[model samples]
Target: MKRQIIDTIEQYETIIIHRHVRPDPDAYGSQMGLKALLEKNYPKKRIMAAGTHDVLLSYLAEPDCVAEEDYNGALVIVTDTANTDRIDGPYFDRGAFLLKIDHHPNEDPYGDERWVNTDASSCSEMIYTLFEEGQASSGWEMSAEAARFLFAGIVGDTGRFMFQSATEKTFEVASSLIKQNFDRTQLFADMYEVDRKILHLQGYIYQNFTIDENGAAYIKLTQEILKQFNVTVAETSDLVGSLGNVKGICAWIIFVEEDDQIRVRLRSKGPVINTLAMQYKGGGHPLASGASVYSWKEADEVIGKLQELCRNY
Candidate 1:
């Protein structure tokens, strides 16, 4: 679609930026990068970047939720969000216009003007393309900050160039960002620098893992376990993928204990995990999928479904 994003930009005196909730590095990167792009190119406009914060490297560009009054005569741009329900902030309805930019396996277009590309590795890559096509000049002369945000989103979505979605274009975007001359060493260090306590907690979680009949390994973080460790809720969920890295496992699952449900994250090397997740009213990419369960019984039932799905892998 040759949708003129700049046309939408030009219509607004102010712009508010948003991303998906439970923000990841890619979501944060694309949101921050687009915010910088707007601020640099359209100096006369007001732009606010806002989102939920609970994960890595997102702190680099903290979100500032704009007041509803700021939405007047403004265009709201949501990045890296596939669904409107997941978009951060409550002021989407307050905007004069809405636009979406995302790279997800599924596209649920949320705005008046939408650009959704599943083939692209990251939304940041799509943002780079938009800037190139729109000829919107960067404020910092292709600033280091913009490059860092874009690169962070790229690396997060590509899993540091390890995911199946990584492509030649992904590298091309990376090359372009590198040309902006940001501090590469510090970027890598900042992005991957895991806290030692997190590692220790990971080790403990790994100790309680179990593999099912079809090589679908899963770990459950019980409330008691969380109490014993004195750690945060997400700390355990973040470590689930490492368990599947065990020599022979094909699929891995993590069931984290939350207030009223168990949050389930599933990953596989050879199967479309989305097939399994969709069965539970959840969905994502083929390789990585997630769903939630109301009780331990439902969790076991989901595990049974995952076992059936794992057979194809």
Candidate 2:
């Protein structure tokens, strides 16, 4: 599969990379890292990374403004996205060839070629493996910038090597990337640095989150509450993880109000919560998932389901 993907890339003079909408570090990292890797090896090829901007990861790379014509004869490679509906743009099918590279569950496979590895810690790790295999066979090199971006994705998705999905293979892949001579300490500093306002937001979550009898911790953030904190919806992405470590809390959820609907971010310490997320309008990994609900009643029902799961566990 790796060789096939490489061969497909070699056949195309234009390659466009994409990821899910409202991308996280893993999405941005894999997309940017693959683009950098391809550009370094195939300098003559026009490789561009396209997606919506993630405010938190904007410092890494900006999404290229790709024209429709760019996909006329291009190979479209989507990374870190599982479903077609989650794709950031409409140009996926416009490409001459489609390739899907992801570490998520294969819920929706919409590509001519796919390399989906759910066991991998992150899509960035998969990209690293692909590059290493491709490099060995084709004598291509992995650049330091590419290594850094890939490393960021691994760390981000693995929660700084704290998540259970991060295994020995994850460490081995990370070691290879770190040996490329990127500043590891600086990268950690950059990833963790936060301003005072964000710190206050954390305090708010800690203070205001409610705990159910079944040890499910939850917080509902309406637009007014978000306005009070003066934070955008994107900034709340990391807040759900903060509730994970609370004492006696087996499950945690954050319900953030969007324009027309409510977005729910669910996390669990050991229980399988993605099933419950799928019952709602979302699906993801077992321990971590996301869902969308139309009203507070729907959100409450989802929460009730999570609470039941916790009680059974």
Candidate 3:
């Protein structure tokens, strides 16, 4: 699969890159990293990064992201997208060919040339492998920009190498990127820095943590609380992942109230929370999953199922 894409890259004159929406560090990292690499090696090719510039503001300043109109007869590289529906940017359809580089567990082919290695820790790692060992002719050297972006993606997806997915290979990639003189300390500080207000909200959320008999922690954020904090569902979705690390906690769930539904974030250590989430019609990786329930009462029902699963696990 990688060789096929490398062949396409060699043949294509124009290359455009994209990723999932909302621009997490991993998505942005893979998008920016690949863009810089392609442009460095194939300088003659026209390459553009596509998607939300506002969301990419933290990682990128003056953006090369372009619109669909700018992308006729170009090769589109979609990275870090788990599913086809989540791939944003209209330029994808405008491309002459589609290529995908993703590391998510589920691989649905979105492009003519798809390189989906669920075994890889991050999409950045896949790109790193390509440049190092794949059949890409030039094996483009990583620029400072490329190194930083790729490092960010690896750090983001692996939770700064804290998640189970982080492995020896992950660190090897990080080490290689660091050799390009990336500011490791500054990047780490920037990546982990949360707003004081969000920190306070997290404190408040933690103060209200509810633990069941089986040591599963849970927190529910009401609409009024969310409004008071000026936080959206996006801000709170990843919060549960932090709670799963508590010493006494075997699993955790955060339920945030939105308009008419409750968004549930589920996480576990020894148990497979994805199955638990699936019981409520939600799905994700084994350690993490999410779902939405209609009402608070429904949320209680979902919690009951989770508790049962916890007891059994």
- Go through the candidates in order and give the C-alpha RMSD of each one to the true structure: 6.8, 6.8, 6.9
Best-to-worst TM-score order = 2, 1, 3
Writing each residue's lDDT as its tens digit, candidate 1 over 30-117 gives 8889888778877898888976666444346788858879888788898898898899898876888888888885557667878888
Q: Top TM-score: which candidate number?
A: 2
User: Per-residue lDDT tens digits of candidate 3, residues 1-313?
Assistant: 5666777888878888888876677888888888888878778888788776542236343347586667777888899997778886766778888887888866576677778888788998888888785424555677887888888889888887889998898898888889997787777776656344468688887788888878777888999898888767667654666675566787888899988778888888768888777767789999888888888998888778778777887
Question: On residues 1-313, what C-alpha lDDT tens digit does candidate 2 reach at each position?
Answer: 8998898999999999999997877998899999999999999999998877867675577889988989998999999999999988778889999999999999898899899999999999999999988889998898889998999999999999999999999999998899897787877776776344567888999999999888988899999988998877888886779887789999989999989999999999989999988988899999999999999999899888888889999
In model 2, the clashing pairs are none
List per-prediction Cα lDDT, in the order shown: 0.79, 0.89, 0.78
* TM-score for each model: 0.67, 0.70, 0.65
Q: Name model 1 segments beyond 4 Å from true.
A: 1-3, 136-141, 195-200, 208-313
Judge candidate 2 against the unseen true structure and give its global Cα lDDT, from 0 to 1.
0.89
Clashes of each: 0, 0, 0
What is the RMSD, in Å, between candidate 3 and the native fold over all Cα?
6.9
Q: List the residue pairs that clash in candidate 1.
A: none
Q: Find the number of clashing residue pairs for candidate 1.
A: 0
Worst 10 residues of 2 by lDDT: 189-198
- Ranked by lDDT, top first: 2, 1, 3
